[model samples]
Target: MLNNKRRFSLMTTNSHSSSQKVGTINGTKVNEMHAVEAPLSGAADEAFVTSLRGRFVEGRFVYRQIFAIRSYEIGPDKTATMETLMNFLQETALNHVTSSGIGGDGFGATREMSLRKLIWVVTRIQVQVQRYSRWGDEIEIDTWVDAAGKNGMRRDWIIRDHYTKEIITRATSTWVIMNRETRRLSKIPGEVKKELVPFYLNRIAVASEEKDCEKLDKLTDDETSERIRSGLAPRWNDMDANQHVNNVKYIGWILETVPIEVLEDFNMTSMTLEFRRECRQSNLLESITIPTTRVIGESNNSINRKPHLQYTHMLRLQDDRIDVVRARTEWHFKQKLQ
Candidate 1:
């Protein structure tokens, strides 16, 4: 039992969502795709679930899940939206936690936090996209946990085209535990520590360096080569379970200003976002994108260097111009799809 002083929150609510029938991705059954909030009968059940999603690769538990790009998941160009890729990554993480027995069930370490009124929040995340998966394309996301600070944990992913096995995107994220009642950051509880520590693997991360997530340039009118600003209003369905506009929805808004030529010939290679505030219903937001690079610099011999373009993005209140999120994206020209 955890002492009240050590326990961060006093939440004791126990609730479970009705399980929905598993749906298919590409003519394949994905039934059991929903979250498991109750513990499995025994270790044998756990092993079976783990094998279905992914397996242990040496020391790390690697989970593989497939996502088929639906029409709604694509942009006007008919390629997968950045938000869709992000959703797949987020779902994979949830699945990983549930299957690991660290989360799921109203009984484990993760629920223990909820039992104590604590919740996990993402502090930062960075993604590097090589190519956007097209509609009808099945993509495989391989996700694993990496060692983070004692109070937090890091997760990384490699997304690939399911059939071709070509890498499409790489992402990494950092998460911290927060008290729901006091709304303050908290250390990992002993229960969670014991459950998560053994799964931490010393492996090369997708977003390798700590500094990659640190600095996101603020958008300003002064610096620019090309720029676009679009008005954005969140729809009713854009809200998530938490009632605020979902984080992935912000990615779609940010990409609205990316040049059509870039979207057609090149691909978004890297993106970093610093979420400063949350937007609720009735917030009128402006999605602004400003290209920061002037030219694709040529090498010493005048040979063409890879086309590199950087754009700074901001989601701001249209009325007051208050910032909700600031992000930066890097793009690379692609010769052809692999």
Candidate 2:
């Protein structure tokens, strides 16, 4: 087994060195997850329609709808930031639900799951914006999963534009269930799980990247075997078009690993994460993940992790091959972590 943390030779060449372990404990195939295919819906079918759904079991069901917007201007749109667009697209995706806000429980309460002591958490979310969405457009979102888990379940979603009937975006997600009091992952009952087994697990979400050497050099020595434990749950407001956790939801997991005080010390200026995977609907991701952390100093705010960006985050799927999604996030420092 390779060490989780590694040291590299600061050679005379133009590349930086990095050390990584070959695999993970639970057989999580990180690189094997990413990319999704829509039956190719056009940009004209997305709209706020809640009339499409099938009640699998007594309490289990599907949620579907569409957003009526078009092209979200990337870079500088005079009215949006990629971050703002990311957050907007996600929220827009989530507006379809008959439930307030988004995610499983909020949607669950509306469906009367009545697991009163349980709550839902979004572990990880990956998004691929082949093209951005625009205003004055209508989008459709489809969500469903055949079953439930003790601590989590899987959920799938798709976003289609109405006027053109083109698929704007698609994604899958993993989530876990938690005890309200203990806040620990629990196993779903057999009866409950068996009820939704019809919804087969999708392949997986995988991402590709050729991160520069600078990213490797940014990791701190102690960041070798970093594992993110828990984070704030996905709130009603955290939902997007398909009524599932949004891509920007991944950032929550990124900073959720850092203490509040530490997060406050830096302003996220630049965040570059490509989605190699998609998450399903009603899936409360557990986030039992460990990634490498890298940090660098910048003179001024140039990207999203603008001015004083202090910290950088690099997360990977502990695998023999390279990980699927290698996120490199930059945060500027307002103050050092105390």
Candidate 3:
């Protein structure tokens, strides 16, 4: 079992000292002063190395991590992109499993799951961004998992400014197991369930009342508002360890069909995505978007409301036209930010 008393630390490089204490985990001290000088090689460099500092908290049920926003993670607006924030959520969730002592070699798989050739796959995810973190900013993220229905798992995350402690984002997702060999959905095995039950939390980061509450509409090509982008193909780097296109890549493709005018005038406040099928590197895809004037959950009488636009998106194979993902996004006027 991990030490429940572990605390977070923000480490800095000191020119005067050879090494400095970063933090403690399971009663062992960690130092990162030398790492700053030597730097990491290969997939991650020095800049990426300094960004990740994480630990377990709340009796080890919740995982908290502090990430320094790197220059590469930010966009032209000098703020972290939606894709960057999603990547942080993914990395934190995987680290949580690794620290729990129940993880197997497979990404986030338990021992029983690895033996059974089962891997977790997300079914749906929703993210609400109240504010975007800027480059050089440090943001703290807390994530926890709970039971979803009888066999599925629900994960939630809350991101805040590390210094001000102001909430920046909230996200929630649902996942289920899939058999690796058969490529089919599977129920939570008894042994795997036993491994996870101890770490499950009853907390929710994104409230249901705050969500649209209505199901995400499955958009078809015919329903799109005359905006479509075709001939999209996955690059080699887009594939994950599981040999499928990474989920975050789908978000980029979905936005490809969105009208440039909408992208310029509005900022995406929330996005809901439903993963229906996996895409491979060999598959060619098309993106479609449907513009809608009516906001799904907003009230007409709401006070101080900013102009909002909603969009429905679809990504599918270009040849067979098989749906890979369906999504909905809500955007608010950029003037609100000004």
Candidate 4:
């Protein structure tokens, strides 16, 4: 096993080597570049390669990376979809763990966690989007972790435009350990805590917003103006390395019941998801949405005003009606983006 100091040194050495290759475009420095073209012969080489993708900052307590928006990641509006942004956040978090030398064979799991057959599971997440990135845009994302209450870990991210340094999105999430074999929640092992405690930072990515202050109300079938979409199942490709449907897939399903008009005319400015249970490939699911406030009509004057459309969403198993996830979303007119 590599000691913390040695691992950190390896990262810095690789980062300095990569920086020497950076070039300028039209007098502006181009910082984004591919990792070194070399064979991964051992763990040390693998760590060096991973450092090229992302690196630790702020005294090695925070991770920062830059990603360029691709064509496939954009929607009809020409801006990167919410799912793409979420994926970026997830990727950076995992890379942070790997670079820290605490990661094990399991995804983002510490060595002690892998020995105990434990994996991390996110319970809740909140994302606020002030702006969306367009195709060919380079966005920088920074992520850091801190303690959540006693047993839980809190991770937060800030996404910004690489050139202007303007904030685009902010997100925060809570995660806990679960036994991979038993599929039950587990407490943090002492050894795992010791490995992670030194890297924790007291930071807030999304401030001025309520943190679990108000509970999202459950939507029922009897509710008026409720929309339901049934007969949803996960594809084989939807499964992550953990042999279960990826959490990002749940966000797509939750929006299936939303009105097309809402999706087209408005941009989702904020979303909060509470994952209650896991979904598998064989399970059928149903999506339900209830409008919490009336959808605003489009008008010439609406462009200048900020009006929010709110909805509550639920995803449950088709047969047992067991809630898989519950969420609340807030949207504003697309004209606001302009």
Instruction: Give lDDT tens digits, candidate 1, residues 173-199.
Output: 777776656757798888767677777
lDDT tens digits by residue: candidate 4, 113-150 = 99999999999999888878999888889999999988
- For model 2, residues 1-338, the per-residue Cα lDDT tens digits are 01111122122222233432332225553353321222222332221112222112223344444433434532222222335445543443344233423234452321222344544444444333333454444455555542334456655555556457766454545555445456555556454354335444443322223112243233333654454443235666666533545656666565555556545454443445544433434334433233334445455422222233333454333332223234554445533321
List candidate 1 segments past 4 Å from native: 1-60, 76-78, 104-109, 181-183, 207-214, 220-231, 295-307, 334-338
Q: What is each predicted model's overall lDDT from 0 to 1?
A: 0.69, 0.41, 0.81, 0.82
lDDT (Cα) of model 2: 0.41
Every model's TM-score = 0.71, 0.41, 0.82, 0.81
TM-score of 1: 0.71
lDDT of 4: 0.82
**CA shift at 279, candidate 1, in angstroms?**
2.4
Per-candidate alpha-carbon RMSD to the true structure: 12.7, 22.6, 8.2, 9.7
The TM-score of candidate 3 is 0.82
Q: Which has the better lDDT: candidate 1, or candidate 3?
A: 3
Q: Show where candidate 4 strays beyond 4 Å.
A: 1-52, 208-212, 294-307, 336-338
Candidate with the greatest lDDT versus the true structure: 4
| Candidate 3 residue lDDT tens string, 1-338 | 01111223244555454444434545565564222223235444432343355677889898888887999998767788889998999999998898889999897888899999999999999998886788888898999999999889999999999879998899999999999888899999999999999999999887757765567676665675498889999999999877799999998898888878777766688888999998999999999988766553454422223337878888988899888998888887654543
